[model samples]
Target: MARYILDHSTRPDPLLAELAAETAAATGESAEMQISADQGTFLTMVTQLVAPRVAVEVGTFTGYSSVCIARGLSGGTLHCFDVSEEWTSIARRYWHKAGLADRVTLTLGPAQDTLSAFDQPIDLAFLDADKPGYPAYYELLVGKLRPGGLLMVDNTLWTGHVADPDRHDASTVRMREFNDLVAEDPRVTVVILPLADGLTMIRKNPDLS
Candidate 1:
């Protein structure tokens, strides 16, 4: 079923496919951190739908997701925050190759620190960084997002461990807490889709305080 879903979904571009392959070959086991092709397609679709002028991504593994988001932007800019220069260097190559270098900016540092420097409104935000930092990132991103803007969070389900009380690992616990917080927040209407690990989409209410 998963294979069929992918087969029916939008096919990745040649550059995206090449980037995914290079990332898998280079990163070995860690390549799983990269978003799946279907998720990439979803990101691009949402980005195009929102047509955000300013977007932010918290995690950029090898640039696959970044490429999707940047490609969908209609002459907007994307600010990517990640702590690894090594991984982002690979992403930079693909961004350059895809002619998105001008539309995207990469910042190497703790996302919390770098994200603090931005006071401008954000039209869209994607969070796929450390699980423990989700709460902090959420607080920051939600405040920065303009009313009616979208915030997409990845890995909220944590491989279904979030619903398993027996699984009390740190990541699982953190995700569970974050999920509950988002669900209860009056600022946004939220829905969690069982895509990949789990993708939670939140749209800030127009009357958000």
Candidate 2:
């Protein structure tokens, strides 16, 4: 249903081609991880709009989205969570080259643990981690987000698997559940935009009770 709508409306941005090339070249190696350029642009646009002072990002895959978010943040702090040192090392070089290393902090560990340790209210949060953990991450992050804070979840469409009842993989199942959960929740307003695999945007309201 949603996939059909998005499929017809979807159009690729030109910026992604350049970023994809740069990200691939920077790694100098092929891997199973990489984000679409359209997604990267979405992150950057969101960051630029909110101009958050403190941001939390779960799943910094090769730092493409991280770099995009960080670039939009002038003097703000961006906390990135990832368990892979090898993957992040590749990200670091690009961060440094992009002159955004100083504003970004990489936490090497399970994202849940890293997120739990934070005591301050997050101005903005990005969740792109394991599909099964979306519920848990949402619980914790929503509690931590300040009023009007933004929460962005990537890969919500699961490559059009969520709507297909026949394709019930664990990841797809979890994503479907998460999507339904968010839609029903009254604490925030959500917009599931069909851009580069689908991004679910949630804006928290302080008065929701």
Candidate 3:
């Protein structure tokens, strides 16, 4: 651990702001990408219980979500894939300050290539990458995740765009398609939660493993 691991509660912890400050300073960007308190809590709870040894995060942004996942798992490594060195560098600094830098591996490049290169089985994964990439990410992750592994995706609701047939933005359209695909994906058990944005959590059935 390189820095303090902020305690995660049902509500947002005050320390989250302090961590965000470090991330913001490093990236020179606003904290718009940070996960909301509710979503953070959900991620923390899942990680703590699942205790995944190998976790993967797509679309790390400034690393807010990665930090949350790291704090939840008592002792496991999170491999974060993102294309922004500027932002991930900021995330790395905060992770170092939080004493969690050692537990997190930041990989810079296209997420698909990085994920495809992963040879080890993944125990848990968080997807918050490009919207159109969701279905592909899911297809890749489902095979990589071991039995009982958890896959939690952020922004599945796309700010309620899926319900509106009128919004035909590329991202929204892709999300709608992915939503339908996941619903029919019999290989895993899925649940959609209306947390900040929206999170679609899937637990891969044991048979798939």
Candidate 4:
């Protein structure tokens, strides 16, 4: 199914393909952390649609996903938060190579601290961080998100283990709990898409008083 979708979807451009190649060669197994080509395509499409003025991404991972989001911005800025200077240094090079240096900013630190310091109203956000930190990141992201703003969360399904009763792992349990929390929260409406791993689309209620 994933193969079929990737086959049908618009493919990444040459520059993006180059970044993917470098990431793979340089990072080895860690390159798997980069968003898949299809997922990157989706991020670009969503960003174009939302046209957010203030975009935030919590996990940069060598800049594949950040590149996708930054490419979609018409005139907005993307603020990326991550804890790895080593990896993000590569991302910086790519962002410069992609001519996106002007539109993107980076802060290297624990996202829990960096994100909490961000005061601007988020028009859109992408969360892909340590699983244990999702709850905290969600709160900060949603709290700063303008009513009706959108937040996309990656890996909420834990490779479909969240639904398999027989597969009880710590990560799966935490993801299930987080999904439940999002589903029950009245402030936002959410739906989990079976994208790579899983992508959860959450929108803060526009009708909130």
Give the best candidate by lDDT: 4
Q: In candidate 3, what residue range of length 10 has the lowest lDDT sum?
A: 1-10
Quote each prediction's TM-score: 0.96, 0.85, 0.87, 0.97
Quote the positional error of residue 101 for candidate 1 in Å.
0.9
Across 1-209, the per-residue lDDT of candidate 3 in tens digits comes to: 21222333455555567766765665464565677766776787889999999999999987778888988877789999999987787678768877787889988898788889998899999998877788888999998999889899988888999899899988788889999999999889999987777899999999733
Report every candidate's CA lDDT.
0.93, 0.82, 0.83, 0.94
Per TM-score, the best of the predicted structures is: 4
lDDT, model 3: 0.83
> Tens-digit lDDT track for model 1 on 64-145?
9999999999989999999998999999999999999999998899999999998779999999988889999999999999
The window of 10 residues in a row where model 1 has the poorest summed lDDT is 200-209
TM-score of 4: 0.97
lDDT tens digits, residues 46-155, model 2?
89989999999998877778888997796799999988897788678778878898999999998788889988789999988877888999999999999999999988
Cα deviation of 44, candidate 4, in Å: 0.5
RMSD of each: 1.2, 4.1, 5.3, 0.9
Residue 69 of model 2, lDDT score: 91
The list of candidate 4 runs beyond 4 A from truth reads none
Q: Mark the regions of model 3 whose C-alpha exceeds 4 Å error after superposition.
A: 1-9, 21-31
Model 4 poorest ten-residue lDDT run: 200-209
